[model samples]
Target: MRSHEHAAIGALCGALAVTLLARGRSFLEKLALWTYGLLLSVFIDLDHFVIARAKTGSWSYLTRAVRHPVWAFTEQESVFPDVEMKLDRLASHVLIGGGLVLALRPLSRLLAVFSAVVVYAHVLADLLREIEVA
Candidate 1:
């Protein structure tokens, strides 16, 4: 999914956290939930940078691709068409990231849950878009 879509999902996650999960909580709790939700939603995509580095052994290509996915997508066919897309390897899209959040929930239930929701929502949105394209 695009950045805008991830942002929308993040907003939704924050809204839900404020309205449903943090309802009746202290102001600070709600604020934390919303803020964490928004940040985690987009931050989860940082996994792509790691994946890109691991695969290509450099960060420059990942930075360029993140800045311009269309160019990268087209270039993939010309330069490395034989290579398969491995976005699915991102920790954010796999159970490891969620498990880490869940494990850390003991530190702050509200923030952890909100962060998990935003992360999973980001993954779900990307998966749905991939299915649509397929």
Candidate 2:
């Protein structure tokens, strides 16, 4: 999916968190949930940078992505298109990242649940996208 799609989903997740869990909560608690939802939604995609760095043994891919944040995922041609991009899928869209979020329940149950939902929603959107190139 595109960066705009991610942002849209992230916004929606934040809104949902505010609607479902924010009522009657303390200001800080509500703020935390809202912030987590938005951040975690797109944060899952950070696996792309990690995988690129690990496979390339260089910081160029990561730095370019960080610099051209919008173009990293939006463009058809990548700076390192030949890299093993599928590593990103295994790292984030699968069970491992979700498990990590689940583990966060010990720290804050609300954040754990909200973060899980936001991440899952991100994965669902990616899965549903029309993959013309695979």
Candidate 3:
């Protein structure tokens, strides 16, 4: 997909996220929805069997997990050498997750802020993928 196409999809996802938030759902519910979407996206990526796609999907999953306090304690391990290599490339994820957890007033607020960040990250990753694939 083109960068613009990926960005468009990101925007659409963002809109759906906002709509879910607007419908009187609790912040936890919104966070759950974001987490589920991200995980589902990863499952889709797994079907493609591309390293770049898998990396992007993994980052998306980590970002979502970082947003939810309940998921912060969870540890994800990969047996694949390439996937394990990418897992080690997560210094920024650690820093961002720490900062978000400290800065937000409540766990829900952290999730809300992180949801926006995750959406942007997905778009950027998609743009990078477009450039590489082109």
Model 3: how far residue 23 lies from native, Å: 1.9
Candidate 2 Cα misplacement greater than 4 A, ranges = 67-79, 87-91, 130-134
For model 2, the local distance difference test gives: 0.72
**Candidate 1, residues 46-95: lDDT per residue as tens digits?**
66656656677877756677688787545543433333454644443566
What is the C-alpha lDDT profile of model 2 across 1-134, one tens digit per residue?
66667878888878887779667888887777777677777677777766777778888987887788678767835756878665366445667557867689899776677777777778777776636447
| Candidate that would win on lDDT | 2
- Please provide the root mean square deviation of candidate 3 (C-alpha atoms, Å): 14.6
Full candidate order by TM-score, most accurate first: 2, 1, 3
Ten contiguous residues with the weakest lDDT in model 3: 72-81
Candidate 2 scores a C-alpha RMSD against the true structure in Å of: 2.9
Query: Which tens-of-lDDT digit does each residue in 59-118 have in candidate 3?
Result: 544444447635432332222324433333233334443564465536666355545555
Question: How many Å off is the CA of 22 in candidate 2?
Answer: 3.5
